[model samples]
Target: MMRRLLWFSLLVGLLLVVMPAAAQTTSTTAQVPEAVEITVGDEVEGALTEAAPSAEYALQGAGGMLINISLISEDFDSYLSVRDDAGTIVAFNDDSNGERNSRIVGLAVPEGAVYTIVAESYGQYIGSAAQTGDYTLSVSEAQVLRIEYTQTVEGELTSDAFSLDYIFTGSSGDTVVINEGSDDFDSYLRLLDASGAELFSNDDSGGSLDSQIGPFVLPSTGSYTIRAGSLSGEATGNFTLSLNRIESQAIAYGDSVEVEFTNNAREHYFTFTGAYGDIVTITADSSRTVDTDLTLNDPYNSQVMFDEDGGSGFDPEIDSASLFADGTFTVILRAVDSANGTVVVTLDRVPPQSLDEGSQIAGFSSSRTQIPMLFTGVAGEKVRLTLTSPSGNTSSSLNLDVRQDGTSIAYANANTLSAITVEFTVPNDGDVNLLISEYSYTNFQFEVTLERVG
Candidate 1:
């Protein structure tokens, strides 16, 4: 009798292979789910048991619907599978979601085809081990969220209280902003790293019910998550989410680039790659009421230079001829005093012009009375520079003021002679600026010569 019972059990298991999957929900007693219609955004509660190892449901339509089947079971490791009406297995899942539960997301189904969703104990799929539990099945439209630079997304918060998601790909030390200023509802924002761990969250940070979280630096170059939500589950209204990437514009030598600030308290960054001891000047111009405030950051994001009122009438300027480092340099442009406007920025690398042991360069300050020039000399080298005019004697005396990085180094005034000469030992390997100003009313041509002797 014992041998006969074991043979019958094995025969019954073999017979299950030939039966419809919906009818094979139980090991011994066959059970099938009644055909039920379901749609996206629908969450249903159901249970499974040892007596009925699987539950089958019908999705009335054909394929092309992105279906997400989630099975939550506390009593057993859950498993999920989908099959066509003809009992052909289409998809399966064991632990794609989390823990021992199962979830199948973003599965595209066929058109005009009926699919059977089956939930079962993971053990039952392998052998005769019986498992039972209650589970919740969530069916919703799975959307692929992607965020790009300067993108604006508009959405609504309805009674369902859905959380909108977006994926942001960024680099380390990059600052980004998530703004919901146009949201009518009490908005909330949350930032998550690639692993879905919360990095930051903000509510009512924009001075109103809307949300704004930013100047947030990314930890690495990868995908990050931004969740747009409401202050509470009950609050619902329309909202707009905007993503802005704050990265420096790489300004090469003699390159001119333009950037704008759409609003106040926003920072625009421009980067330039230069060598150590290089001199650079940045000029910001705007036609609007926008007064620019400029800040220079080294490769390590450290503040090395700042200017708020050094330009032509409220514009920002940076005219440093001696840079300390030789890497990426960041130039930050901000609107002054909470003003918003467009600003055109240009960067010029102004290194010291190299002169030979005895070289001469001629220039004229004819149309203007003042001229500025730059030159370089080596340390310990006795350098002699002579500034002369066309006439042997002029009514106006020419004044010469030479400076190294804004510090006065030499000065000369021609009272009655045709030329002014200044000879001094080179202080360092830096550039010197010559400010030639006329003290009298005379338009004159000038020649500057430098001779090195030591």
Candidate 2:
């Protein structure tokens, strides 16, 4: 006889073509009887024996109604099948929702179509060794729970329904965050049509045993489904499911936006329009409690830069970077390696000032550490760049970085030098940044002079 042990693979929802011409329910004699009439919320008790091994019931419901059928049996490994009025099986199962018993879900037969529910032991239904037992078959309407925005719902991961399902509606560009947390089980979360772009996930990608999916942007306007269950199939317990909507705001050239992260969400996103050939800087700062990570993606969804701990301690900053494309760019803010908290992100556009031959621009290193400038030079032409601190000439530290097409052609830092002066042959002509930083925390002002006397 075919015996379904729980540890064995619990295959469900497979068509059975070899069902015996059998009978059912407290009888040894085989009978060709009509299908019993039933409806939702009906439970019928029957027996499956070698001679009388199967029984059928006809269901009447409104058209387009979704329903679930279950065959539970302690005395036998149950099998189930549902057929429409046209005699085409709509659904069948050997194990339903990770159990030895059977269940058919989302069975939406045509309106006015009759659905026949068949129940039998696995072995007898497939024409194998004879088996007999009592069973309880149930039919109910399909239920899809909804996790509302900012609402936390308590749920249980039970064997009968290993995966709890919820749905929400979203528009084309809406970003969403979902969290599934549990102290008893390692939670697992999945989106039904999950081929869309995702900004971040938590638990598995967030932190610790909590499970989260999204920071996912909906690609269209419709109902989206979220399935929550245990990461490990063996776990079962109480869990919480939450949904949060992320509102993206436009960022200007030089403004700071502060956002927070909870255990439910670990990442946030912002967008900005940048012009081609623009030089910009971005910084993310938070208290010591938060470790920030930042990612910049161009309009084509390609990553322009990523930074972690490139700012002050536990913060992230992208310094003096060039933007080659003119379009809307995305900035991703994330918390890494620690509990989530508030983070302030700022974008600064550094307009290039002319540094022509024998010209000098007085600049200061205050909150902004780098000053961008444009200097045109021939491929083989050499030039000398000089820096002087007004607090005292050559008294403060400085650096000069020249770049072409985002690649560095020449770089110079004061290190142990008393003066910051660099001379190099121009490599393919572009722009550079003359930077003065608080070396040893000594605040100072400085000027950079470009000379063609190389």
- Among these predicted structures, which one has the highest TM-score? 2
Per-residue lDDT for 188-212 in model 2, tens only?
Answer: 7767542221224334533457765
For model 1, residues 238-318, the per-residue Cα lDDT tens digits are 888899876556677777776656753367767678765566778888764687777766654445556777678888787
**Which candidate's lDDT is highest?**
2
RMSD of each: 21.2, 18.3
- At residue 168, candidate 2 shows an lDDT of 79
- Summed backbone clashes in each candidate are 5, 4
Worst 10 residues of 2 by lDDT: 12-21
- Reference-based lDDT, residue 395, model 2: 42
Candidate 1 residue spans exceeding 4 A from truth: 1-44, 47-142, 247-454
| Deviation in Å, model 2, residue 373 alpha carbon | 37
Instruction: Indicate the TM-score of model 1.
Output: 0.33
